[model samples]
Target: MELLIKGGTVVTASGSFEADVAVDGGKIAAIGKNLPVTANQVVDASGRLVLPGALDAHTHMAMPFGGTVSADSYLSGTRAAVCGGVTTIFDYPVQHKGETILGLVNSKKEILERDACCDYAFHCCITDLNGGEILDEMAQAVEEGITSFKCFLVYKKEGMMVDDGTLTRLLLRARELGALINVHAENPDLIDLRTEMYLKEGKTSAWYHYMSRPEFVEAEADKRVVHWASHLETPVYLVHMADKEGLEACIRAKEEGHTVYVETCPQYLEFTCDVYKRPDGRNFVCSPPMKGKESQDALWTALKSGFIDTVATDHCPFQSYEKDWGKDDFTKIPNGCAGVENLYPYMLDAANSGKISFERVVEVCATNVAKIFGCDNKGAIAVGKDADIVIYDKDKDFTISVKNMHSDYDHTIWEGKKLHGYPVQTYLRGKLVYDNGNFVGKPGMGQYVKRSHK
Candidate 1:
C-alpha cells in the first residue's frame, strides 16, 4: 500500500461504517476493518468521518459577465475547492460567435491545464449556434469526452439565449449522442419586460432585482423545459433551480417517468430574497434570485426526500467594487455569488445539526454528481475508486470568513457563518493537498478529466 487511513467511520452514498482504507497508485487498494496493510504513510482518523471529496458540478471560475470577470482564477478557485473538500470541479466554458464547441472547450482546457490546482472537467456552454455549425460539433465534443452542455433560456441581449428551435435541435441530438443538456431556466421575454417596467418605475434597488425574477419567471421556464424534454423523451438537467413551482414541475416530471435532474446551489438553500433589502443586497444578485421562505423550505424538503439530484455551487464571485456597479441599478450588477468553498461545510453543518443524514450528504455532494456527470473513478470510498477523500471532524468549530479563504475574492456571502463540522484534511489522488487551513498543493498539478456520457 502507498498510504493507509485507519479507524474512521467511512460514509458512502449508500451507507456508513467503521473501516480502514488503503491507497496505492492513486486508487483505493482495499477497504475493510483493520486492513493490516503495510504502507509508506498512515493517518489515524479515530474520531473523524472519512468520506469522498465533493465534485462541484457547476462553477464559473474566471468567467466574464456584465463587463467584469469573476474574481477567482483557476488557480485560486480550485485551491479554494480543495480546501473545502472538493477535489473535482466541472466549469462551464462559454462559446462566442463563430466558435466551434470543441474550440471553446479546448480553450478552457488549456487554461485549466496551466493553472488549476485540482482535477477538472468542462460543461461546454453554447451561446451561439453559429448557423448550426456548433450543433454539428456536439458529437465530436462528446467523442472527446465532453458529454454535457449548457444553454440559457434568458440573456437574449447577451447573445446567450437559445430559442426553442435551437433547444429542440440540441435536445434531440443530445438524446442520439448520449449527451446531456443543462438549462439555465428563466423566461427571457418576461424578465426583459419586468426589468424595463421596474427601471421605468424608478424601482432600481436590489430588492427589485428579486422582484423582477420572481418565482414565476423561473417556474414558467422550468415547466417548459420539463414539457420539452418529456415530449422529446430525453434526459435534461436544470441548473441552479430555486423556486417552489419549479420544484413541483420537476416532481411531476419524475412522477410521469420523464428524466429530469435538478441542481440547486448553497445560496438558495441558505438565503432568501430578504437579503436584497439589506444595504449590501446587490452582492446577492444572482439569476433566479433567492425566493421567499416557502421556497427555501421546499428546497430543503426536496433535498431530504431525494427529489433533487445534486447540490452544486454556482461559484461565480465578483469583488465588492464590481458588485457596487449596480448599487443604483440592479441590472448592471454581476449576477453571481461565491459558494464553492462553503458548499460542503454548510451541508455538513446541517447534517451535524440533525437536519440530514451523513449518507445523504455524501449522496448529494459527491456521489450523485459523479453519477450524473460521468465521473467514473471519482465519487466513492469503495475499492478501485480514486483516492480523493476528506477527513472531517464533525465537532471541529470554525467560522467562515474571507480572511481564512483561499479564493481571490475579497468578500463572501458566507462571511461570519459558523459551523460545527468541517473538512480538516483533503486528499487528491492519494496526495495530501489541503490540511488544517493551508493548501499544500501546487498550481497546474491538476489534470483535465475526460468524462463520458452519463
Candidate 2:
C-alpha cells in the first residue's frame, strides 16, 4: 500500500461505516476494519468523516460572457474546488458561431489539461446548429466520451439561446446517441418583454431583474422542456432550477414516469429574491434570478424527498467592477456568481445542522452526479476506485469569507456565512492536493476525464 487512512467514519450515498482505507498506485486497494497491509504513509483519520470527493457538474471557469471573462481560470477555480473537497468539475465549453463541437471541446480540454489543479471534463454547449451541420458532430462528441450537451432557452440576444426546433433536434439526437441533454429553461420572450417594461418605467435596479423573470417565466419553459422530452420519450435535465412552479412541472413529469431530471443550486436553497433588495444587490444578479421564499422552501422539500436529482453550482464569477456595469440597469450585470468552492461545505453544514442527512448530502454532491453523468470510477469509497477523497471534521466550526477562499473573484455570494463543519483535507487520485487551508497541487496535476453516457 502506498497510503493508508485509518480510523475514519466512511460515509457514502447509502450509508456510513468505520473502516480503514488502503490506496496504491492512485487507486483504492482495500477497505476493511483492520488491514494487514502496511503503507509508506499512514494518516490517522480519528474522529473525522471520510467521504468520496464531490463532483461539481456545473461550472464556468475562464468563460467569456457579457464582454468579460469569468474571474477564475482553470487553475484558480480548481484550487477552490480542491479546498472544498470537490475532486472533479465538469465545465461547459460553449460552441461559438462557426466553431465545431469538437473544436470547442478540444480547446477547453487543452486548457484544463495544462492549467487545472484537479480532474476535469466538459459538457459541450451547442449554440450554433449551423443548418443542422452541428447535429452530425454529436456522435463524434459521444465517441470522445463527452456525452452531455447544454442548450439555452434564454440569452437569445447573446446568440446563445436555441429555439424549440433546435432543442427538439438536440433531444432526439441525444436519445439516439445515448447522451443526455441539459438545458437552461426560461421564457426568453417574457424576460425580454418584462425587461423592456421595467426599463421604460425607470425601475431598473437589481430588484427589477428578479421581477422581470417572474416564476412563470421559468415555469413555462420548464413545462415546455418536459413536454417535449416526454412526447419524444427522451431524458432531459433542467439546470439551476429556481422556481416552485418549475419544480412542480418536473414532479408531475417524474410521477408520471417521464425522464425529467432537475438540479437546484445552493443559492436558490439558502437565499431568496429578497437578496435583490440589499445595498450590494447587483452582486446577486444572475439569470433566472432567485425567486420567492416559497420557491426556496419547495427546493428544500424536493431535495429531502429525493425528487431533486443533483445540486451543482453554476459557478461563474466576475469582478466587482464588472458587476457595477449593471448598478443602474440589471440587464448589464453578468449572469453568474461564485459557488464552486462553497458547494460541498454548505451541503455538509446543512447535514451537520440537521437540515438533511449526511447520506443525502453525499448523494446530491457526489453519488447522483457520478451516476447521472456516467463517472463509473468516482462517487464512492470502495476497492478499485480512484483514491479521490475528503476528510471532513464535523465538529469544526468555520466562517466563510472571501479572504479565506481561494477563488480569483473579489467577492463571494456566500461571504461571511458560518458553518459548523468543513473539509480539512482533500486528496485527488491518491495525492494530497489540499491540506489544512494550503494548496499543494501543481498546475497540470489534473487530467482530462472523458465522460460517458450512463
Candidate 3:
C-alpha cells in the first residue's frame, strides 16, 4: 500500500525541514511541501518528526560467544530494532576456525531468512586468517555481498584476535578488494599484564574488569591499527572506542585526511566504571569495559565534535546466568549488553535534553551509518530511497523497561530510563510494522541487503 507521511519536519543528515513524503512500491515516490499524491494510507505526522529509520551498523544477534549464544535471535532482535526506529541492521557473523567465508555467510543467511524482521546485512568476521588463504577469502566475501570484515586486536585467549602480522595482511587484502575492515582495538598484552597484577592483589570484583584494561591499552592499540591502515591506505572503523586519548588519535587522523571512522556505544557514553561497583555490576560487563567519568565525558565530546561517526549498541546481550560465569572471573563474562530496542528512543532522549541536536541524531544514528556501510537506499527521507521511516511523537514520554521491550532477552540496561520523545509509529518498506508499544513485524519479512564495494 502507498503511504503519505505529511506535515512533519523531515530530518536528514544535512538538516530538517517541513515536508510531505509519499511512498509507493516500497520506495519514496515524492517529497514536497504538499505532495499531490493519493495513497492507501495517510499518516498524520503533524506536530511530529519524520525521520529516516536508524540503520544500526553494528549488531550481534544469536551470535555464539563466551560459551553461550546471545540472548536475542534474529527475529527478536530485528523486531526490537524496528520498534526502536531502526529499519536496517548489519549484523556481525564471525567465521569460526575451519569455516569458509561462504559457509559461514550462507549459514547466517539461512537464519536471517527464517527469522530476521528488518532489512539486514552482515560484516564477515574473520577469526582465522589461515595460511594466507584468508586473503583470497576477503575478495570472495565482497563478491558475496559482504563488504566489511570484522577483526579483533583483543580476544587473544579466545583464539579470535588476529595477530598484527595477520591484521596487516588482511588490511592489504581488503584494500585491494575495495572492502573495509572494522577492528575491536584493545592491546591484549597490556590488559593481560594488568589483569594478572590485579588478581595477584586479590582484586576479583567486577571493578577489576575496568582496571585491568586501562585507557592506554585501547589508545595504544588504536594507534597501532591506525598506523597500519595508513601504511596500507585502507579505511578502518574502530568499534566502541571509549577513551579520551583514543578519541584524540582518531580525531588527529581525521584532521590529517586519514579514512578512519570511529564508533562508540551508548553504554560507554552514559555509564562509567562505577556501575561495576553495584551488586549486580557483573551484568554490565563487556569487552573494552566501561571507563571512568572523565573518559565518558571525552567520548560524548568526541561524538558531538564529529570525531565519532556512529553510536551503535554492539547489542550482544547475555542473560543473568551468563553474567554469573564471569562473577568468579571477569574474563568469563559474556561481553555485551541488550541495546537494539533502545537505540532510537535513547538517542531521541539525548537530543531532546540538549546533549545533541536533532539533526545530529539523524546524522550519527542513521545517515552516516548508511553511508559508511554502503546502505544505498537507506538513511534519508528522499526520492528513490527505501521508505523506511519513523513518525516520532515529540510530545510523548515513555519509561523503558524489559516488560515492554521486544528483545528475547530477560533484562535491560536502560531499564526505568524515561525517554521524552518516542517513536509513535514505524514503517519498514512502506509497511506499518510498529505503533505505540506494539510490534507488527513478521519473521522472514526482512531481506538481506547487498552492499556496494568501498
Highest-scoring model, lDDT: 1
Tell me model 3's lDDT, rounded to 2 decimals.
Answer: 0.88
Question: How many residue pairs collide in each prediction?
Answer: 0, 0, 0
TM-score (all chains, Cα) for each model: 0.99, 0.99, 0.98
- Summarize candidate 2's per-residue lDDT along 164-192 as a digit string, tens digits: 99999999999999999999999999999
Encode model 3's per-residue lDDT on 292-342: one tens digit a residue.
Answer: 888999988887888889999999999988989888778778888988879
Ranking by lDDT: 1, 2, 3
lDDT of each: 0.93, 0.92, 0.88
Point out where model 1 deviates above 4 Å.
none
Model 1 lDDT on a 0 to 1 scale: 0.93
In model 3, residue pairs whose N, Cα or C atoms come closer than 3 Å (at least 3 residues apart or on different chains), thus clashing, are none
Pairs that clash in candidate 1: none
The 10-residue segment with the lowest total lDDT in model 2: 445-454
Q: Per-residue alpha-carbon lDDT of model 1 for 1-454, expressed as tens digits? A: 8999999999999999999999999999999999989999999999999999999999999999999999999999999999999999999989878888887877788888888888998999888888888778988999898999998999999999999988999999899999999999999999889999999999999999999989999999999999999999999999999999999999999999999999998899999999999999999999889999999999999999999999999999999999999999999999899998899989999999999999999999999999888999988998899999999999999999999999999899999999999999999999999999999988887888888885
Candidate 2 segments exceeding 4 Å error: none
